[model samples]
Target: MGIKNRLKIMSFLQYFIWGSWLVTLGSYMINTLGFTGIEVGMVYSTKGIAAVIMPSLIGIVADKWIPANRLYIILHLICAGALYYAASVSDPTIMFWVLLVNAMAFMPTIALSNTISYTCLEKNNFDTVTSFPPIRVFGTIGFILAMWAISLFRFELSNMQLYIAAGASLVLALYSLTMPLVPTAKKKKNQNWVSMLGLDAFVLFKKPQMALFFVFAMLLGAVLQITNTFGNPFLHDFASNPAYTDSFVVKYPSILLSVSQIAEVAFILAIPFFLKKFGIKKVMLISMLAWTLRFGLFAFGDPSPFGFVLLMLSMIVYGCAFDFFNISGSIYIEKEVSSDIRASAQGLFMTMVNGVGAYVGSIASGKVVDYFTVDGMKDWQTIWLLFAAYAMLLGILFFFTFRYKHEPEKLANVGVKH
Candidate 1:
């Protein structure tokens, strides 16, 4: 097979494995396994924790010691083992640790997938800017297909989802081995250990705006895993409400949530326009406003078709909520920072958003849920409202802190960032 075909298959499988369970795991945890909010949050946060530290480390090793393709295969193999073990678990405590192991192996691969793609495309002399997003969108398509497969196969609420994930992961792992090898090019003779490690991204914290951007990035990062933790189960919970059982939203919860991924693709296409017109700060403010609406919509949505529509709108808004801030802000940082530290700065943002931000959101949300528990009922509305309020407050803060005015010439000159 040609390199492009190999990469396309690998990309498809990368997200297909994740989509098999990512959107529906909360439902499985709560509706099937009866795990509480905290446990569910922790399960989701494992992704964040993995997102925090591993991507950069893996990137460094890929840039230094190991070939990206080789590392990618190794991580997937490790992930396969942990995922199989996780699927067989009956206990939450053991499940947490097992999930953590799977998370570490899998999380870094997301970024690594990007690295591999860029390297392959560059090696083959393809224009990444014009060509890559279309290819990347296939990953989202694969993700949606996997979600449908899991739900349709009735694997959504079972350990079978993990089996599905493991199968896809193994395919990805094995397929990755056949892809063109991306060997680390020695950058400089006797590279400094710290420089080689890409630890320099930490220096971005010195700038006041960088610090604030990351702080809010972490704060908003709280929202990152919330839907993944409760969204499907939230709709499934309507099954208990009688009025919502026959509802399309309840019956087709995964499809309802899949709209978010659909919206993500749309939002991504709109980004260049939005960035050119509004600048990153305003665009991020838009993200905060969009997020405030996302959770708030869920608090009031139902399981019926109309409810599903409302949920779909919530999903549609998710594109703006996610793509605007994360992708756009990274580009903004890339425009401002030097190339040598650029990779590290991107890693730092991921650490803040996925790591510290995710940790805070999960732990805090868990506490909020536990506190709201009374007589075996969770105050779901209150929890969502609190989140919405927090996002609103964050929007207000970001508006004041991040100062930028759109200059078309400058934006046109702006380069591609991670």
Candidate 2:
């Protein structure tokens, strides 16, 4: 297959694994397994926990011993097995470890997928900056398809959902064996084992601007997981109430939430325009500010169409809030870094937000939700309001603490240095 065809298949299967679970796992956790808030948090935070070490570890293996394609296959095969084990297991704590292993393999693949595609593109002298986004955006389409499947098929409540992810992963794992081999980077004779493995991205801390950006990346990452980890269960919590049981929000929550993906598709086009118009710093601040509204709007919105309107609008804003920072930040990293460490820098970036931030936020949010929603009362309003406040506080602090002067012409293309 051509690079384009390979990327198309990779994008489809790459997100298929995640789409099987991410949106509806909250509902499954709350309504099915009957796990406690902390346990649920820990389980959901598997992605975060794995984020800390998995990508970097895999980066080393890919660089030194194995080709990226081979490591990619290994990760997915491991993920498939672990996810299947999770489906068979009953204990939440055990499932934590199971899912943790799943995440350990799965999360790194996000970075690895990029590496594979970028490698192929670079070989053909294709521009990663422009070519990659349009191709990669299809991953979001896969994600949307997975969500719709989960809801339409009533897989959210099934233990078999994990199996669905595993099956897709199994397909991806096998498919990878047939894909073009991404050559492993040859190690330098004097390269420190750690540095060769991409640990050098850690030295980004030596620069104050770099340090500030990462810290804020972790903070913003906290907001990113809030909706994914809890919003479904929070909205579905109303189903437990007699009055809202028949509501559209409760009946078709995944479909309702899928609007965010639709919004994401539309907003991605606006990012270049926004970046040029407002610059990265302001665009991100706009995102954080929007997140503040996101949670707060949910806290007050009801099960009725009017309330559901607020929920829908929040989903719409989610595109702007999420895509702007993630893609723009990735581009910013590409712009600011040396060409050599750029891939590792991207990996570390994912590690911070999807990794460390995810772990902390999911567990913390769970504990808070458990505390407020005690005695059979699901105090989702209070829970959302707290998150809104957190977003607001982070936005305020980020505005004063991080300083970057954007040059519009510089923002237009990737790999262009000022």
Candidate 3:
């Protein structure tokens, strides 16, 4: 009925569309479609590929021509069609193109959703710093719900997940038409090609501290994609072992994976205190260490007893590994970059983490998995340990290279402002 509620719905469906397919799509491809590791990685890498180009181009179109909300609706309509087609594809090549189209239509909407929400909230005189986080929390809830629905309904390895995502995309498309309109920005006479394309954000690289932060952001981005691409399949692979065949972890991997999302929500709430107490640099180091634990725990974890505890620990630490870098990094970038290129700078950050970084992570992770597979059986423990070693190496490098003194006063007022 109100603006906040409308924004909440938008946030919910925005992530729900992604959650329906993202976490379990690898499992579906691996178990049902019989796609190889490389094939599955190629499919998922479409998001990264699309993210590199589409979001900035779409942002320009939204700024100069279409209103954000209207463009948002249009993208969802196209995404709905793409997802429907993706559900019917049998060939990996065809599926790659289909998902790439879907990613192109869907990836830009994430930024558009935030733009729409910020505009509507400010227009209604709501303090976004205080109001937006609570509304955005619903997005994570929506993601978890989608995962639960797919798992509980036994659709985790079925094309039905894509259909569900397509249906939700269509619903969101229609619902978005009723949202508050966001006007496009008027064209400026002196704008250059770089500024128009949001490439002006690249200027942040001129600063040493900002440059280091983004480099590590890209590295961590790669780390993030590794789990998303393999975690479900890894769990499902446990069925090969007799002792774990009937275990709850194997039976309901998505529900178990949803623990990571739940942990994400809890960690997000604690970010403000962590920021005020530790500042960005230490918070980032903590995230790096958490990432090490996240992968290391998985290296020895199983579906039962003590090993299950390790698995649970991995899920819980995922929150810290993810939020401490991503959410906090965004906040840090906001503080570091100039406001004039702020939007573009944010776009650059996403491009690094979600675009190029994700692409590299997916492809490399696929190669690693394939390398560890002998006689069609994957050595998951070795694979996970290698990842853990990578994370630990990154932590050591970051500790020595990144230098930022704590400034609690600067962030004392920074409590989930995004």
Candidate 4:
């Protein structure tokens, strides 16, 4: 098989493992095992904690000791074992630790996969900028397929989802050995701990604009985690109402949620044009408002015919809410930061969003959900409205606080740098 084809397959399975379980696990924990909102949120927070701690440490290991492909293989092997064990865990605390192991093992592989792809692509004389996006799109396709597979097989509320993810992780572990090796970086003398840990990017905090941008990034990151950790469970809640039990929305919630992923793929393509036309400030403001609409629609949506339309609109707007900030934020960082700290700055961006933000969102949202529950019945409408208000407030604050003068002509150079 061609290298690009091979990379595409790698990308597919990498996300397939995640998609099989990520969206449905909350429902499984909540509906099947009768776990509390706080417990489930705690479980989800493991990913955020792992995201903060693991990626940089693993990156150092891959840079100094092991080949990237070899490390990728090892991490997936661990992920397989961790996920397999997770299937048998019933205690919320035990499950938290088990999933944390899986998260730690799994999160770093995302970056490692990209590193391996870039290295292999360059070695094969392909332009990464042109070639990698198409290959990466396969990952999103794989994610959607996995979600459909779990939902169709009726495994979304079962431990079988974990088994499926474990199976895929194992397969990827073995398959990774076939990929070309990626060399470790040459050891450099006198590398300080700050640089070694990628903490040097903290210098960006001295500048108010960057400091504010990062603050908003972290806040939006929280928004993303809130939806991810709760969206599936919220959809699954409709099953309790006999009036909606037979509806497609209740019967195939994951598949419906997959529409959000579909929108993501479509919206990603629209970003470069949007960034150039609207400028980053306006584009990001649009994203913030889109998030408000996303949650507001969910607050009003249901399995009824008209409500179903609202649900679909929420799924569609998720693309705008997610990509406009995430991809655009990365582009803004790349354009603004120095080349020397560019990679580190990117790492810091993810740390703020995925790491700290996810952790805070998970725990706090859990408390909010529990607060809205009485006699084990949740006030989902109120909960969603509260979240919508939060997003809207962020949009207002961001519009006033983050001041960036956008240069459309300069954005043309942003893509070229890659």
Candidate 5:
């Protein structure tokens, strides 16, 4: 098989592992294992905690000691074991620790997979900018397919999702041995610990505009986490109502939630046009407003015919809410930062968003969810409206606080090059 095809398969399976459990696990924990919102949030927070520390440490190991492909294999192997053990865990505290081990093993593999892919592409003389996106899109497809598989097979509320993830992780680990070997970088005497750990990127905080952008990036990251952590459980809650018990939304919430992933693929194609026309500030503001709409629609949505329309709209807007800030923010960082710290800056962006932002969001959103629960029944409408209001407030603040002039010609080149 061609290298591109091989890498596509790798990308697919890499995310397939995550897709198996990420969306549905909340429902499983809540509905089957009888865990509370705070407990589930604490479990999910493992990903945030792992994202903060593991990637940088793992990057150092891959750069100086282990080949990226080899490290990827090792991480997936650990993930397979951790996830398999997680399936057998029933106690919330035990499950938290089990999933934390899994998260630590799994989170770094994301960056390692990218590193492996980039190395393979460059060695084969492929243009990473042009070639990588198509290959990466398969990962999203893998995610959607996994969600559908869990829902269709009635594994959404079972431990089978974790087993499936564990099996996939094992397969990917074995398959990774076949990929082209990525060589480690030789240690440089001049490299400082701050540079190695990506702490040098913190210098961007000195610039007021960049500092404000990072802050908002972290806030938006929290929104993303809130959706991921609760969206499935929210839809699954509809099954409690006899009137909506037979509806497709209740019968297969993950499949319906997969629409958000499908929409994500479509919206990514629209980003260049939006960025070119509106610039980063306006594009980001649109993202914030889309997030507001996403939550507000969910606030009113249900399994009823008309309410179902609102549910579908929420799914559609998720693509805009997600990709606009994430991809656009990366581009903004690329354009603004110097070449020396560019890579570090990107790493810091992820740390702020996925690490700190996700941790805070998970914990805070969990508390919010619990606050609205009485007699074991949740006030989902009020919960969603409060989230919507938060997004709207962020939009308002971001509009006034962030200042950047749009230069069409400068960004035009970035669009053309990508």
Candidate 6:
């Protein structure tokens, strides 16, 4: 098979493992295992905890010792075991520890997969800028298909989802050995621990603009986890109401939520144009507004006819809310930082968004949900509205605080170096 097809299969299985369980796990924990909101939050927060340092730490090991593809295989193999163990646990605390181990092994693979893909593409003389996106989009399709499969097979509320993910992980682990070997970075003499560990990326925080950008990135990162942690559960909550008990939205919330991923593919195509025309600041601002709409629509939406429209719109706006900030932010970081520390800088960005942001959001949103609960029933509308208010506040503050002038020449020159 050609390298692109090989990479596409790799990408597809990469997210398929995650999509099999991520959105529906909360509902499963809530409905089947009877875990509390805080418990579920902590469960999801395990990903954040692992993201906090695992990626950079594991990255150092990959760069200095193991080849990327070898490390990728090892990590997935470990993830397969961890996930299998996670399936047998019912206690929240034990599950947290199990999932944390799973996250440590799994999160690093996300970056490693990119490294492997980029290296393979460059070796084959393909322009990564144009070629990689198409391959990456397959990952999203894989995620969508996994979600549909789990829902259709009624695995969403069972341990079977984890089994499916583990099977995929095991398969990927073995398949990864067939990938083109990515040589480890050569060790330089007299290299200190700081540089070897990629901690030099931390120096970017010395700049006021970069520091502030990361701070807000953390805040938005929090927003990202909130929906992921509870969106399906919120949809499933409607099943308790007689009016919505038989609604299609309740029966296949994952498929409905899959609409967000579909919208993401479309919006990702529009990013280059938006970045060139409006610059990163404005583009991110649009993402913030879209996030506001995303949550606001969910606030009033239900499984009813008119309300389902709102739900679908929320999923559509999620495309902008997610792709714009994440992709644009990465591009912006690439523009501002030196190429030498580019990989480390990207790691730091993931740390801020997925690590600190997700941790804070998961914990805090859990408390917020619990606070809004009365007589064991959650007030989801209020929860969503509060989230919307938070996004709106972030947007307003970002507008006045972030002050980068749009420079078309700089953006136009991007990717030319690569």
lDDT of each: 0.75, 0.80, 0.83, 0.84, 0.83, 0.85
Q: How many pairs of residues collide in each model?
A: 1, 0, 0, 0, 0, 0
lDDT of 2 by residue, 1-418 (tens): 6787789789888997899888777568778888786677768777888998887677656755678889889889998999888888768889889998998888888878877776777677675555666667778888999988888888887877889999999999998888888876655678886676567667888989889998888888878877777777777788887989998888887788889888887776666677778787898899888898889888888787788788888889888888877877776676677645555676788888898887677767767877996787878888889999999898899899888888877755554445
Cα lDDT of candidate 4 equals 0.84
Q: Candidate 2 has what TM-score?
A: 0.90
Q: How accurate is candidate 5 locally (lDDT)?
A: 0.83
Off by over 4 Å in 4: 1-4, 30-38, 60-67, 115-132, 178-193, 196-198, 239-242, 331-344, 407-418
Q: CA lDDT of 165 in candidate 4?
A: 96
* Stretches > 4 Å off in candidate 2: 26-38, 189-198, 408-418
- Mark the regions of model 3 whose C-alpha exceeds 4 Å error after superposition: 30-37, 63-65, 119-130, 183-193, 196-198, 338-342, 405-418
TM-scores of the candidates are 0.86, 0.90, 0.89, 0.85, 0.85, 0.90
Candidate 6 vs. true structure, TM-score: 0.90
Task: Report the lDDT tens digits of candidate 6 across residue range 170-240.
Answer: 99999998999887666568988877765767888888889989999999999998988788778989998
User: Any residue pairs clashing in model 5, and if so which?
Assistant: none
lDDT of 5 by residue, 135-235 (tens): 76778789989988888899978999999999999999999999998886654578788666645567789999999999999999899989987897799
Worst 10 residues of 1 by lDDT: 409-418
Q: What is the lDDT of candidate 2?
A: 0.80
- State the lDDT at 78 in candidate 1: 90
Candidate 3 — what's its lDDT? Answer: 0.83
Q: Compared with the true structure, what per-residue lDDT tens digits does model 3 show for residues 302-396? A: 98899999999999999889988887776676556544443455566777788878988887888999999999899999999999999889889
